[model samples]
Target: MKIAIASGKGGTGKTTLATNLASYLSEEKQIILADLDVEEPNSGLFIRAEKIFQEDRYKMIPGWVENDCTYCGICQEVCNFNAIINLGTHILVYPELCHSCYACSELCPTAALPMQKQKMGVLKHYKKGNIDFVESRLDIGQEQAVPRIAQTLDYINSISDNKEIILLDSPPGTSCPVIEATKDADKVILVTEPTPFGLHDLGLAVETMQKMNKDFTVVLNRFGVGNADVEDYCKKNNIRIIAMIPDSRQVAELYSRGELVYDKVDSFKQSLDSIKHYILGK
Candidate 1:
């Protein structure tokens, strides 16, 4: 079963749940813990993976062949992102705005546009104990994360078939990168808190998953600190509350030291085991 852990907002303990779940299940199963949050990947901080392989993740961008150019505006016209623009005497390619769609190059009348691969990120594979970790680090200042995420998924496919249970730590929010990460997941675990902000964001995340036709459960982190808005929302929507992790000083201290919560909280394992069983049944 492929399960993705995600949240609509940041600081909702999404990574905490994902990392601990992977750690708990690794003892009895062959699992791949994939950190698909390229912007700020922290899964490696919790579970260290021995570096086995590393490679640069690249995305295609438009390259203008000035030598072969007839300054036709076709390339600029075909580019939907405004990545390619034709000035009076020159054709410009903006690498950052470009999505590497190849439409500009393909529609160039004189074939003056070619595509070049730009390094977008780095994909790294590592193994620690029984679990395999696959992570992607987006290049600094890179705006587009979908291509890098696609590269990460490709690495996941190459390493293991769909047979082994995979746990994905997705990026926060309901964006394209988040969608790409959760696209093929069999079940999604939406982690939230018991606050008004958490309730609002959780609704958005739930709607996104429902639109994608994914089965999901909610985990309320820091359950006692805030009001019952999240729980009420879940009940109204008929969403199951799989786990409620109480707010604790120990969890805060462990998180500050970059430690996994399950290492200190023994009872957390039972909730994760139940979630695992629930996912497997689906």
Candidate 2:
């Protein structure tokens, strides 16, 4: 089963929940944590990912082959992003503006346009003890994050044997990147705090999940710090509340130092085990 841990806002503990859950569950089941936050993936920090393989992802951008040029304006006319502009004397190709749609190359009447592979990001796999890991790191100053997120998911899908448990640490928000991360998940755990901002964003995230036809539940982090507004809203909407992590100084210090809060053989372990049983039903 694929369980995605997501949030509507950043710093809501998606990685905190995902990494600890994967560590505890890997004891019995083959588990892989896919960090789909291409913009800034941090789950690897806690899990200590040791990469095994890597693949380069690229998009096909158009470039004009000057030797075979006929000064055709068809390429410019077909480009929707203004990627290709043809002046009478010269044709300019802006690599940044290009969407890599290949329309300019196909519409070139003189066959002077060629496709060039532009590096977008690197998708890599890692192993640490019983857990396998996958993450995508987008190039700096790149705007195509959703595609890289998709690429990361695709890597997980291709090598996954179907018997393992997949947990995706999704990007925070209800935007395209989050959608790419949450789609096709068997279940999603929407992590949030108990504040007003948390409740508001959780509503948006819930709407996104409903529209995508995904089954999801809520995990209230830092429980009891804020008022009862979040609980009241969830109760009114009939949303399932899966887990509640209490606000404690010990957990906070551990988290601050990049330690797994529930990885020890203490009461915290029991809490994590209960959540695992709730998720796997075993």
Give the C-alpha miss distance for residue 34 in model 2, angstroms.
0.9
Model 2 weakest lDDT span, ten residues long: 263-272
Candidate 1: what lDDT? 0.87
Residue 153's lDDT in candidate 1: 85
TM-score of 2: 0.93
TM-score on alpha carbons, each prediction:
0.96, 0.93
- Runs in model 2 deviating more than 4 A are 264-271
lDDT of 2 by residue, 1-282 (tens): 899999998888889889889998888889989999989988888898688998898878877788888886898899889988888678899877887788889878777888988899888899987799998898998887887887788889898999899999999999899998988799999999999899999999999999998888898888879898989898999998877887677877888888998865255566576678768875
Error of 1 at 118 (Å): 0.4
Q: Count clashing pairs, candidate 2.
A: 0
